[model samples]
Target: MLGIQNLSLFIASGLLLNVIPGPDSLLIMARSATQGWRAGSAAALGVGAGTMMHVLAAAAGLSALLATSAAAFAIVKWVGAAYIVYVGIALLRSKPGKAAAPAALPPQPYRRIFLQGFLTNVLNPKVAIFFLAFVPQFISADAPSKPLALVVLGCVFNFNGMLWCHALAVFTAFASQRMRLKPRVTAWLSRLTGGLFIGLGLKLALSKPN
Candidate 1:
């Protein structure tokens, strides 16, 4: 178990990190704004699940390979960037319908949304590298159960992330209800989201390994 001092500090740092808007937050907001609460919630869960994979990989020392190998990092980074750009393009191409039509329009399959969210997090090498660097700060090299400690810490981080994401989903969903009534406004929002995604993809693509 983590000592009280470490646990408290980790929680505080995690919350602060989660509050700062990032690609994950943008994805959740976009999904909620465009597709409503269900899609957004699915996205949040997907992101958490993907993050768990990185946490486990970090615990198992797999992320070290990624961190050390330029080829590995580039491959994952490009794939992630491409995928994000693809999604952005798809969003841009979508025809705007009446705001009132969303209710009548069938909801996107939860599985599809979930997968989109999952892939979004999993493909980002930045996330893998983040875990590789961030999780160990709280761990002691002398700890008897280092892997267990990392897992526990990762769980706490993911739990905190889930709460923040869910809250974002709910708030956006509420705002979207009114926004959806305005076709022009909805169209513009979609365009803005699409543009943001493309920008994120470009930024990710251009990032250098630390």
Candidate 2:
């Protein structure tokens, strides 16, 4: 059906990949821990939206350009790295009130959080390359429409990823509630996450095109 092959294997592989810790998962978890589940869901949805862009790009064969063109790849990579670093710095600079309740801690506009998640996924040229390389395996050669096949495969992967991301958000929020972390402790967690983001951003910046 739809020129798809080994779909079970593809879905299994996608699930495993989604479980691996990455910027997408980290952003969702961080938002859930600091804000509530709703905020986490916003981030998760934003990520899903970003995945749709990649899916469309893949269907249009734009990803192939990113995979082959050094200049295009470098431009996107630097922009993505810079954005991630900027977000991390903002988190590091944020200071929550010592007495603020978990609910009372300053709330970032959910729209901004959503945009953060969207850019986090969409701006990474590596993601486009990964889709170009990975999504094709399950699509049969000589498919009726190669572009349609790519879209189907990309949508499946994104759906599975969204499920995992939302689950992570819920779980993180639940665990944080259980622990009842103090405001000071939450602040420290935020800072730690910020540092991790910085490290991840630098790593991405330094990454060689593959």
Candidate 3:
């Protein structure tokens, strides 16, 4: 069983981490800005699903393998970076007019958005490494069931992440409505998001294992 003090600390740490915008958050915001709340929500749910997979992997000690193996880490890192860059390119190529005219553009299937979100996190080795490192800190070595404790803690973290992501989607969706009226603004937003995705991809590619 988790102690109250440990649980409290974990919750605080999780919230603090979630508040700092990362690749997942950026993706959600970009989707919300371009598509709508539905797409953003799908993306957030996808990320949550992916994170849960990491939690399961961590419980099974697979994430630890990723953390320790250079080849495995590199492969996942490159794949993730490539995928992000691909998404950025797709965004850059997207028609600005379509973005400005939400009603005119065909609605994107939520399943596709969800899959993109899932792949983005699942392929990112850094996320796996993060789980491997972060979750164990709050787990007592002498705990009755370490794996169960990890799952519980991971659920708490993921719940916090979902709440934050959904809030971001709602806010971005609201702002997008106003921004969509200005053709120029909508165009610029797409370009900015595309650039952000590309930059994040490059950063991920260049990152060294800690």
Worst 10 residues of 1 by lDDT: 98-107
Best by lDDT: 2
TM-score per prediction, in order, is: 0.92, 0.96, 0.92
Candidate 1 or 2, higher lDDT? Answer: 2
Candidate 2 contains a number of clashing pairs equal to 0
Local accuracy of candidate 3 as per-residue lDDT tens digits, 65-172: 888888888888999999988877766666546443753223578998898889888878888888899889888777777888888888999999999999999999
Model 3 Cα shift for residue 59 (angstroms)? 0.7
Q: By TM-score, how accurate is candidate 1?
A: 0.92
lDDT of candidate 2 vs native? 0.86
lDDT of each: 0.82, 0.86, 0.82
Off by over 4 Å in 3: 2-5, 98-106
In lDDT terms, how accurate is model 3?
Answer: 0.82
Candidate 1's residue-wise lDDT over 1-210, tens digit each? 442227788888998988887667877887787778888999899999999999999889888888999999899999999998887776666566665565322357888888888988999989888888888888877777877888888999999999999999999889888654565556666667777888999999998679
To one decimal, what is the Cα RMSD in angstroms of model 3 from the true structure?
2.1
What lDDT score goes with residue 120 in model 2? 94
Question: Per-residue lDDT tens digits of candidate 2, residues 112-174?
Answer: 889989999998887888899999998899789989999999999999999999999999999
Better TM-score candidate (1, 2): 2
